[model samples]
Target: MLKTFRISAILEGISYLLLFSFSMPLKYWANITEPNIYIGYVHGFLFIAYIILAVFFAVDKKIAPKKGIMLVLASLLPFGTFYMDRHYLKPLSAS
Candidate 1:
């Protein structure tokens, strides 16, 4: 489950970066919208997956409420999931 969460987290982060950095530029600057639309859908799916997995994992692991909140909050920031993977989820998996 942790491994699955980790994969989801990584994919979520990548999708976010792609949408924010690459797709958004293509949409507004160049007036190209298809890539943004596709990436947005993917990012939306992965973002939901990451949150659901985080909630389940938190419950299963009995993590602190603050930590669980951090998990959700991390999703909103660029590169934050990687930080959570390194500093939070990896330790949970090891335990």
Candidate 2:
């Protein structure tokens, strides 16, 4: 389950970056909205999956309340999931 969350984190992070770096630019600057459309759908799915998995993992592992809050907060920021994966998830898996 933790492994799954780790994978989800990575994917979610990448999608978020792509949305910011590629999709949004194309849509706003180039007036091309297709990429954002598809990427948005993907990012939306991954975002939801990340949240659900993070919640389940936190509950299953009995994560500290603060850390669990961090996990949710991480989902909101760019590159946040990558940071969370490195600092939070990896240590748990290593155990």
Candidate 3:
């Protein structure tokens, strides 16, 4: 479960980065909006998956409610999931 959650988080983070850093610019600045449409859908799906997995992991591991909330919140910010994975999830999984 932890491994699955970790992989989901990483994919979610990459999708987020791609949507904001790549797709968004292509849509607004380059006037190429198709990429945003596709990337947006992918990012949205991954975001939801990440949230569900986070809740599942938190409940299964008996993580504190606050930390669980942080896990969900991290998905909202660019690169935040990676930070959480490195600083929080990795260590938790190791133990």
> Using TM-score as the measure, which candidate wins?
2
Q: Go through the candidates in order and give each one's C-alpha lDDT.
A: 0.95, 0.95, 0.95
State the lDDT of candidate 3 residue by residue for 1-91, as single tens digits: 9899999999999999999999999999999999999999999999999999999999999999999999999999889999999999899
**Runs off by more than 4 Å, candidate 3:** none
10-60 per-residue lDDT for model 2 (tens digits): 999999999999999999999999999999999999999999998998999
Instruction: Please give, for residues 3-84, the per-residue lDDT of candidate 1 as tens digits.
Output: 9999999999999999999999999999999999999999999999999999998998898999899999999999999999
What is the descending lDDT order? 2, 3, 1
Candidate 2: lDDT of 50? Answer: 96
Ranking by TM-score: 2, 3, 1
Q: Specify the poorest-scoring 10-residue window by lDDT in model 2.
A: 86-95
Better of 1 and 3 by TM-score: 3
Report RMSD (Å) for each prediction in the order shown.
0.8, 0.6, 0.7
Question: How high is each candidate's TM-score?
Answer: 0.96, 0.97, 0.96
